[model samples]
Target: MISEEEQKKEGKNEKLLADLCECCIMLHVGFQVSPKKVTSVGVHHLLKVVLKKEESEETQEEVERAFLALKNIAMWVKIDKELHLSEIKEIIKYHQKHRNLTHLAYQYAWEFLIHRFYSNESLEIIIVNELHFGKEAARKLEELRKNVDWTRKEDERGKETKEVLVITGWMKTIKSYFDSCKLWNEEYVELIGSVVQIYRTAKDNYEEIRYWCVFSLRNAAGNGFVPVDDLLKSGAVGCVLEDIRKPTLIDEITHHSLTFFENISRRLKEKTYNEMEEAKRKELKRKVLEKIEEEGYEEIIISLHERLNTLKRKYFYGDELSLNISDYSVNI
Candidate 1:
């Protein structure tokens, strides 16, 4: 298998260049590269070529054939599942660049599949693209968010409508929109503060409200409206506060997400500010090393080692240190 480093070395057009030919050998290799790694730009380029061909008797047949091949790649190989959320945003940017939304429906389909496979109650971090500036993306996301089903108890009186808590990528899209608006961040923070109050009040009485708090924490993490570290820590606190509710089977099941959130939350807190700062410094040094090579700089290999050793001594070992989690032991 070609390493990601090797693929990166070949430049970004790896799959697109490979897919242009009809030969089975090249096509087979392209398919083997995995849909997850198959850049969306590559897919869209192929789609454009097929769809825009000058009309001939065989044009429709050829386009259909190409579409089928790409479709098979998307479905059979689970490209969406392989793609990172950031990569999807990059794909969307590629489409926007070409003024093509022809495969947008496919993009949404992939996003949904990615969410379905990756999202669960326990996962704390959800990296989502902030689509505040794109009207089309906002509209599409609004349609998805509208499916939130909220209901109320018949016996409950003088209460506001309760909606099913939605855990989704769209909330981030909406929050990003608000953050981009003038005075919205101030309002957004106030709104979250109020919600935090509600969570505190309802902690004793309402299981549903507790659920909303958990959901909001995840949304806040995805939107980057709040530090992921803070939201996660709050989630751990929720496990302690909500433990008194004696949650039902369903609530118990849902609490798994809260627990996962708690785990990630604690992990982040364990990461000292000093450690992160030192790591960043080391990273900058590494980048400088790479830049030196890129510029074809001539330097003594021994001098390079000495310089690296000095930098490493200052930043490499401190109260601030890097982390590598090879395994996890969860005590439930």
Candidate 2:
């Protein structure tokens, strides 16, 4: 009994419902999180865009159903900072109280906590400021800080949280040391020293200390020419050098350093060769007539031709030579 327009509308409605359901299912299973959780455009706008073609009743029903489903389920991984901060706190408390701190939910909360803390400096500050005895998170954080030197009166009283904060801050700036050829070596060194010091002081668990040590080592190694020999002499590489020597520790440091050295050497050699080529290119013009007169141009040309053929055989083929423009020149 429906008209053509109505049937088309119904199809559109079905498609929209299917899409919304798909999105909701993805959200439930913990996937496809929006990059920036707090957008200028509200959730309502997102809903509008997603449900644009659906019938009002179908859209409304789907939205309500999805919301209800979410209400009953606990969020595992959330990109939404505002929702994440408090909801995860409540979840942690529940897990701790139930003596289920080792449960799936606990691990999930702890993982999210690490991710959320590392996600942004400002978020980290907010979470740290909100931490206290009443919230079981304070104890968890205290555990995380176990390797940090809390023996100092200031650290014990939480007055000197700056050391812990510095280690935390290094995560973001550490990457800059890798990409920039002119990156300050001192900054990288200081960061490594500070992070290691904090880890050692914290008396953190073996894993925590190991984690920071690796981070420090990786950041330091990323700088192509770290004063690694000097550090070894100073005993700074003592803890991690053994780790690096181990094959299972990962080859990233060695690989990164080798690649960096290779790139630098390649560029330097290329530059030197280019300068030599330019000088040769210039000399070839002046020497063209003189060399041809002294030595028959045909012989010179023949020799060059042979050299070019050799280069082609080596580089162009399976051999190791490379041909250049100068390799085939003649006086004429």
Candidate 3:
């Protein structure tokens, strides 16, 4: 009862799968023996194949294969980011929108792209920001938040079920953008609200989500890149205040919160911000200093000097340099 078109489509899929399998085997064996040298042209063709198959309504298995092939190729060849603007936007557009297609995307973003060799000061950042990649990530994270129960219980989170790890991995990748490129793109700023919303709503036992959310926000707050209005609008400052106020907060979370406050005030600290070219920018920096005082955050920062001294004296009693808390500055 199969139609002729359906048969042809099945044949095409089978051939594509066979090709992907062969590609994986070849790469796997080649890598074990020695590193392979793939040219940029070869890498580009492979990327095209991966994109073509992934963008189609292929089966999940096919999508996984495509990304696996991407991983293998990336191990050998640094992707030539000299891609044309139109091509860069198209690639990021698909990758961001189809982030939920497979877990391989998570590893590729973290393990290969961001963690390893991706460059800064590239057109890639501009295109990704313009495409609203961060907004797409926020949307995917919101969707994952609903199925989080599947990941909470130890038994339910078995070998094959690692949805939450994928979510965190992608969040880490985005955080790298803040630390590395430090762009002031508005869409990236908007992502902060979604992370805070998830952190507030998830159950107390769901610490992975909260931990990553705080860490990511901490980087953005401290990086001195994003505009103050955009950051304030994203609700990040309020959410961080809540975290600081929590009675049972862990030291790591508290440490990051302090860093976040420090970084936000950096605008006023170093003559560090070139945005000072305008009078409004200077006022915004002053507002940051005022907000820190309103919440008694300056006091909290002062306490960290003592806390650091105690930690160093306990763990590193013999090292005089480690004991120096005199240089610590609240910079208000």
Best by lDDT: 3
User: Would you estimate the TM-scores of all the predictions?
Assistant: 0.29, 0.28, 0.66
Model 3 worst lDDT run, 10 consecutive residues? 317-326
CA lDDT scores, all candidates in order: 0.38, 0.38, 0.56
Give the TM-score (vs. native) of candidate 2: 0.28
Off by over 4 Å in 3: 1-49, 52-58, 68-77, 83-117, 150-162, 272-282, 302-304, 310-332
Report RMSD for candidate 1. 19.6
Model 1 lDDT per residue over 237-296, tens place: 333334323434233323333333334333433433688765754553344334334433
How well does candidate 3 score on lDDT at residue 84? 29
Top of the candidates by TM-score: 3
Residue range 1-332, candidate 2, lDDT tens digits: 11222246434454344345445444544644342321211232233332232335655455444333332222333345665356556544554555433222233334344444433435544433342211333234334456455555533544435335433433323332222223233433444554445445553323334454455454454444554332333233433433333334333332322222223223223222478775654453344334334434334334344444443443321222223433223222
Expressed as tens digits, the lDDT of each residue in 77-116 for candidate 3 is 5555553235434555666655544654534433344433
Better candidate number, 1 or 2, judged by TM-score? 1
